[model samples]
Each structure stands twice: as structure tokens, then as C-alpha cells.
Target: MAEKEKQEDYRVEIGGDDSKRSYTPAPAPSVSNSPTMAILSYCGASILMTLTNKYVLSGYDFNLNFMLLAIQNIICVVAIQGAKSMGSISYRDFKMDEARKWFPISLLLISMIYTGSKAIQYLSVPVYTIFKNLTIILIAYGEVLWFGGSVSRLTLFSFGLMVLSSVVAAWADINAAISSYGHDASETATALSTLNAGYIWMLVNCLSSAAYVLGMRKRIKLTNFKDFDTMFYNNLLSIPVILLCSLFLEDWSSANIDRNFPSAQRNNLIIAIIFSGLSSVFISYTSAWCVRVASSTTYSMVGALNKLPIALSGLIFFDAPVTFPSVSAIAIGFVSGLVYAMAKVKQQKVATTSLPVSSASSASMRDGLKN
Candidate 1:
């Protein structure tokens, strides 16, 4: 009996030991995966926006364009707040007071309006996308000059390549636009004038976009506001600015809703508006989600990737040209932008790891030394 009791006790101890050994802590959840999803959502939104521009705004005057964009931004504000509520996040935690430093936000609104209007006027969707990416190069140079940061020779070479590629793409777009108007004797003069105007507007758009990017980076870092909160504040601030711009700059007299479209096209326009609203919400939410998961540089690269699909879709939908040189330019620009992004990410990771060890680690090391 004594032997049996000892054996049972030993078995219980072994079983308990086995149970403890089998136990494993759960893995840390990955935040990086969310960025990939966010990127897809953003790309999807761009495609929807392209479709809206092509079909809905076909014969409408410029006033409608401004109004539609304002409406989209308004929808974005509401959607972002909805997303925050659903996610159980509080804007109060992000410190709204910091947004009072408004220069960057105002610049961003200006950039958006300038870029949107100019791209629609002068360049095809694909061409605008290729050149708009210059903002990234601008930001890099801005940092080197404004912040006294060191830039590698490779980065400069990459920028040069992108510039050369943009020239090639622009040449192709100009040729395509000219050829399309060749059959229309009456419209040729108008097309030429529009092209010149587009070029000028796009230049301003690029400069404003660059300034906005650099300023936002500096301001966000200084304020240390959460990404969601920054987005919310930016969208909110942009609403009033855009509204004012539209009210003054747009020609309301030309906005004849019924006359602009045929009976058959009216339904299509409504459908486009619905889709635009949905896409705006998706874009605002996913972009904020992406910033939370990945660094801003990564988000920017993903944004560049969105241009490819937009370009391709524009070609198919709007009968935009797809010349060899233009395609090559886009390919080179995208590759270089991606390379720069990867380099930035690597540098960021290195900087993060190189930070000093926590106080706990230092204390533990001292305790060991004393022991």
C-alpha cells in the first residue's frame, strides 16, 4: 500500500510537469499585416475615383468638379469619425489642441485642390500620376536642405532618373492628346490652349504637393499626434477651406445639372456619385489604418503603387495612350520610388533598434554585476 501511494504521487507530479511544459504563450499580434490590407483599400479607392472622373464628369463644367471634391471630403470626415467609434478609439486621447499649429494642414488642403484641378485640366490621369510622384523626391531634397540631413549620391541619381522618365511620359501624353484632336478641326484650338493651361497648373500642383509633404512630416513629428487624430483634424479643417474655395472660384452659372447630361447618362452620374462617396470613406479609413501599422514612408510608397493601376485603367477607359517610352518612364519612376522607400524603411528600422536600452535593462545589468 505504501509503495502504491508513492507511485501515485510520482505520477501526479509527472503529469503536472508535463502540463506545464506543454503550455506556450501566445504570439505577439502583427501590426504590419494591416498596412498591406490598407494599401489594397487605398488602391481600390483610387480606381473608383478614376471611374467617377471618367464617366460622371464627362460633360460637366469645372464647377461640378469642385463641388464633388468638397462633398467627398465632407464624407471622409464623417466616415473617419464613424471608424473611430467602431474601433473603440477616442480622439480625446490624441490631444486636439496640438492641431492648432495649422500651417501644414492648410498647405495640404491647397495641395489637394491644386493637384486635383490641374491634373483634370491639363494632363491625362496617367500622366498626372507619373509627375505627382515628384512630391516624394521633393520631400527628400527638402529634408536634406531644410533639416540638414545627409542624402546619399544614389538618392540623387534616382531623382534624376525619375525626372528623365517624367519628361518621356509627358511627351507621350502630349502627342496622344494632339492626335486625338486631329479629326476634330473645330476643337483643335481649344485642345492646344487647354494643354498649355494644364502644364502650368501641374507645375504649381507639384510644388504645393512637395511643400505640403515636407511640412506635414515636420509638424506631425513635432506635435507627436496619433495618426488617426491628425487625419481627422486635417479632413475637418479642409472642409471649410474647400467650401470657401468652391464658393468663390467655381462658376455656378455654368452648373446646369440637367443640361450637362442626357437622360440616359443621368442615372450613370448618380451611380458614380454613390461610388465616389463610398470610396472616399474607404480611402480615409484605410489610409489612417495604414499609418497606424506602417511608417509614413511605407504608406507613401504604397500610394505610388496605386498610380500603376490608375494609369492602366485610364488607358483602357479614357483611350489614353500607352506609348513605349511613356510606359518605360512610368516603370523606371515607380522602381526608383520603391527603391528609395525601401532604403528609408531600412534606415528607420536601424534607427529604432539603435535606440538606447530601456532603464530596466540597465538596472538588471547593474544588479547582475553587483551579484
Candidate 2:
């Protein structure tokens, strides 16, 4: 009798049934956090936009950039719907019903307009293109300082490389201006201006973009919204903000609508419009997705990839002179930026894998005992 009782007790402990017991597996991590594919799309979009702007829209004046942005946002809406129909995840799960969620989106749209306009106005095409890398450095430091996270040494090295590459890429332009305009002439004085008026605008762009990323991260974590939902809301909020800014700041009454262009120019403008629109959609979506999957530092470094192609295209299309020093700088920057991005990815992967699973098993045992 005693032996039988002991056996029964052992069975109860193992099976958790005699008194009560149960088993429950922990919920798996959501797939939404893995956004590598999205990051690639963002990088691709950057390259496409650079190509179009350089080769196709050189002489067009139909507000092609604005038109492309509008079209891209529309396409983003369509893409979200498509994602939903395919039974992929969406933002509906977040349960957010407040109007306040749209604020950050509006800020982003305003920043884009201001930055784009200012870049065209004050900086040479090459300078504007190269300075964009500054955004990466700003974002990386912002994340570390504001979020209380430490940046890895590899990441810092990568940022240094990117900054170096950017300076090198602009070297050819700087040298040419010095040679043609004479190193000490007043007429050429503006050409040698470093971080001129337009650069200030780009700095604003960097800060606004950082705000968007940081704000959106907080919002998503709090609400548990899907990527598509966040994107949709952001785009929707941007429309009115863009329109309002255009009305007050831009000279809408003097807007030109003529399509007059040489046959070749017209063809190029058409190509630019299509490519720009596609790129806008790709970059906007992928960037947000990247922030969700990886740290801001990683995303920022990935953004620097645009400089390589942009610099090369400037040389090929505009006959921008390339020098040995400039070339070396570009190579160094690209390698460093790549290294930083790889390190970030490794860190994110480790973080995901480190999640505890034992708690779920304990909960299951307790439930079984209660039953």
C-alpha cells in the first residue's frame, strides 16, 4: 500500500494531475520585428532616386520631386491594402483610437519639404548629396545619448569611415572650384563656402528624421501597432501638413505648369518622375521598418550606402572630376559604414535570442497544480 501511494505521488508530480496541474508554452516573438528585407528595399530606393535625379530630371521644372512624393504616398496606401489581403500582419491590432498619434507623421512631412527645398536652393548638387551622410552620425549619437544605450566600437569606426568618405567624395568639386575660380577671388568666394546656408536646412532635416524614428519607436512599443498601420497613419498625417506648408511658405500663385522641354529632356523627366515616386515609397516604408527591427545606429549607417552610388553617378553624368584622394576616401567610408551596420545586426540578433523561456514553463506548471 505504501509503495503504491509513493508511486501515485511521483506520477502526480510529473504529470501534475492528481491534485492539479497544466502546461502552457510561451508566446513566440512576433515576425514583425524582423525587417531585413525592408532595410534592403530602403537602400534600393535611395539609389534609384539618386539615379533619377542626376540623369533624368536635370532640366525639368514641373515640381517633379513634389509630384513623385505625392504619388509615392498614394502607392504606399495601396501597398498596405495589398499586404492586408495577403493575410500578412497589419496595424489594426494596436487599438489606437486617438488623434494625437498623427503628430510625428506630420512633423516628418514638413521636414522633408523644408530639407528638399533648401538642398536645391543653397547647395550644389554634389555638396547636397554628400552632406546627407551627416544625418547618419547625428542619428547614431542621438540614440546613444538619449536612449541610454552604448554604441559598440565597430559602430563608431563605421561612422568615422562614412564621414571620411563623404569629405573625400566632395574633394574633386572643391579642387575644381579652386582651380577655375582662383583660390582668392570674391566671385569664387561663394564656391568655397563650407556648410553654407543650405547646410543649416539639411541639419534640420536630420533632426526631424531622428525625431520621427525615436517617436515612432515609442508609439509602436506602447501601442503594439503593426508596421503597415504605422506607415499608413504617418502618410495620412503628412498630406495635410505638406499642403499647409506649401500654401503658406511656397509661392503657389507663381507655380509654373508648362511641359515645354526638348524631346530628350521630356523623356528624362518622365523617367525621373516614375523612379522618384517608386523610390519615395520604398524608402519611407523600409526606413520605418528598419527602425523597428534594428537600432537607430544600424539604420543610420545603412543610409550612408547612398553616397557611394551618388558620388559615382555624379562623376559619370556630370563630368565631375575624380581624384585619387577622393577615390580612396570613398572606399574607406564605404567599408567603415558596412562594418558598423554588420555589428548592429549581430547585436540585435543576440538580443532577440536572449529572451527568457523558462518563465513560461513555470507558469504552465503552476496552472497544472491549480487544476
Candidate 3:
């Protein structure tokens, strides 16, 4: 315990003091209180998961979004259970009461993932990356309304830049699509129609993502769930919801299976699916941990910073065009992220400096009560 305190003391100097924050989303368990570690882990997992999911959903004939989600959830549960049996991880066993409380977030998770997949299907990764910045805006205001947290003016300015980046990205995506296709005027409007669908889905994804983050933060307080427990409940509850969607909503006919899982691509799809499922366990856990140790808005900002590598990966693997407008937008978005981080650092310093005055007032109140 002395050693742990010394480690935490050293981290306080390096990572800023979490206890000094005006409002904490929830009390973080000691094991997962290192905000820096949580943020870095989450960013890595998030980037990998996004690229892998994109690869899986990239198949032109793939239309089994619900089925794919169900498989991922199943794999998460299996992986966690296997790890538990091996004594590699520690988390509480299944409890009906906890599951009941966590079920709503599971529904939100379904919407977030389903809409995300639908959007990425119709959009390029670069366009998708820029549009996701909109979620940070939503989550920032959400933290204000729900957690009594305040957004600094600098942060708000950064938000404006993020919005500009998205608009520029959308404009560039459209122009590039039309010009690069080299289609004659006689061609139909297929590309435009697809892009329009993607935009609609992106809006829904942003909304669902904000709600999921806020909802999970609130639920964490009520459930007293650690990151591992939250992840366990999320994947476990999602399995049934996704399975239900796959059963009634999705076509399960033999013909559809062959179309979605073509013989030539079957083995590759399986491999990707397995890898995605395994990685999801870490992604979900680290996400919950980041939200626990830091605010949802900060978690969102880390996501913003994470897009640089993501955009590069998208270009390398997915053939997303590297155009001037796209590069400019990525640069603007990256700058916005840096500005927001600076804003947060300033905000924390102010909070920490005021703590002594609050402590003094509390001491006086205690003395008065004793009298």
C-alpha cells in the first residue's frame, strides 16, 4: 500500500491530480486510476478495432451487421471467461441485479455500433474520421448537463475548429468522388446517393455515441462497476439484443449467407472476425477505464488525437484518396485536439489551486460542528 501511494504520488505530478477536479464522473477504482495509462490503452485499442472492423465490413456483398456484432459480443464473453479460468483477470461473476441496471447501456451500444458500421459502409475512412469529431461536441455539452462539468472557452473554440474540419472533409470527399471517377455526364448518380446515406448514418452514429458515453458514465456510479465488470456486462447483455436483431430483422437465408460470406472470402472474413472479437475485449475495457479515470469529454478528445494514425492507416490499407482538402481538414482537426488538451490543462491548474481554500472552509465547518 505504501508503494502504491508512492506510485500514485509520482503520477499526480505527471498526470495532474484527479481528486482536485471540480466534478468526477464517478469514483475510479484504485487499480485503474492512472488516467494516462487508461487513455493510451484506449486509444490503441480504438484505432485497431476501427481499422479491423472496417476491413470486415468492407466486403461489397457483406450485409450482416447484426450478425457480425453478435459474433463479436460472443467472442468477448468467451475471451473473458477463458481469461478468468486461467487466473489472468479478476472481475465479479454474473449478477442479475447488475445486469438489469446495465441493460439500457447495452441497447445504446447496439445503436452506436450498428450505426457506425452502416455509416462506414457508405463513407471513406477519412470522411468518417472527420465526422466522428462531432461526437466530442455532443459529449462536451453532455458532460455539462449531466455531470455538472464546465467546458472552457478555449475548448469551445477548439470545438468550432472541429466543426470546420468536418465541413471541409465532407466537401472534399464529394469533389474527389466526382472528379476521380472520370464518369461521363451520362452516368447515373450512384456515388452521390451512397454518400448521402453515409452522411445520414454518421449523424445517427454521433448521437448514439454521445448518449452511450453519457449513459455509461451515469450507470457506472449506480452500479459501482469497475472497467472489467462494465465490459463484461456490456458484451454479455449485448449478445441477446444483437441475436434478436439478427433473428427477426436480418435475412438468414442460405443465399444471403453465401452472399455475405462468399466462398473465396469466407476464410479471410472468419479470421478478421475472430481477431476483432478478441480485440474488442480490450477496447471495451480500456474505454470504460478511460471514462472512469477521466471525464467523458477527455475520453472523446483522446479519440480526436487518435485519428492521425487512423487516417494514415485508412489511406495505406483502404485506398482513401490523399487530397489537399482532406489533408488540410486532418491538420485542422489535429490542431483542435492540441488546443483542447491545453485548455484542459489550464482548467485543471485552476481547479487544483482553489482546493486549499475549500479545504480551509471545510476545516472551519468541522470545528464549528464540534463546538
Steric overlap count per candidate? 1, 6, 0
- Return the candidate ranking by lDDT, descending: 3, 1, 2
Give the higher-lDDT candidate: 1 or 2. 1
Which is the better candidate, 1 or 2, if ranked by TM-score? 1
* Candidate 1 lDDT, 1-371, residue by residue in tens: 99666555554222465464333334467644666676776677778766666555544543366667677667767776776779855563434466568546655665656465556645677777777667656666666687655456555666776687688887776676678888987677787777677777777777776666556656666776555566666667677777787788765563465555447677766667667766766665566666567655566556656677887777777756778877886787777666655655555555568754322211111111110
Off by over 4 Å in 1: 1-35, 54-62, 85-88, 93-99, 182-186, 259-263, 294-300, 345-371
Taking the tens digit of each residue's C-alpha lDDT, what string does model 3 give over 1-371?
A: 99666556544232356645332233455656889898888778877888888888876467889998999999999988898899977889999988888899889889998999999888888789888878877877877776666777888998999899999988888887788664654232677778899999999999988788778767777988766776778889999889999999999999999988889889999999888887788776676667668764466457557877777777788978788998898888788878866776576567668753222111111111110
Model 3 — TM-score against the truth? 0.81
- Could you say which candidate leads in TM-score? 3
Q: What TM-score does candidate 2 reach?
A: 0.66
Worst 10 residues of 1 by lDDT: 362-371
- Judged by lDDT, which candidate is best? 3
Off by over 4 Å in 3: 1-42, 185-188, 285-301, 355-371
- Tell me the tens digit of each residue's lDDT in model 2 across 90-163: 55532346337656655765566556555544444555566665555665566567654555777677767767
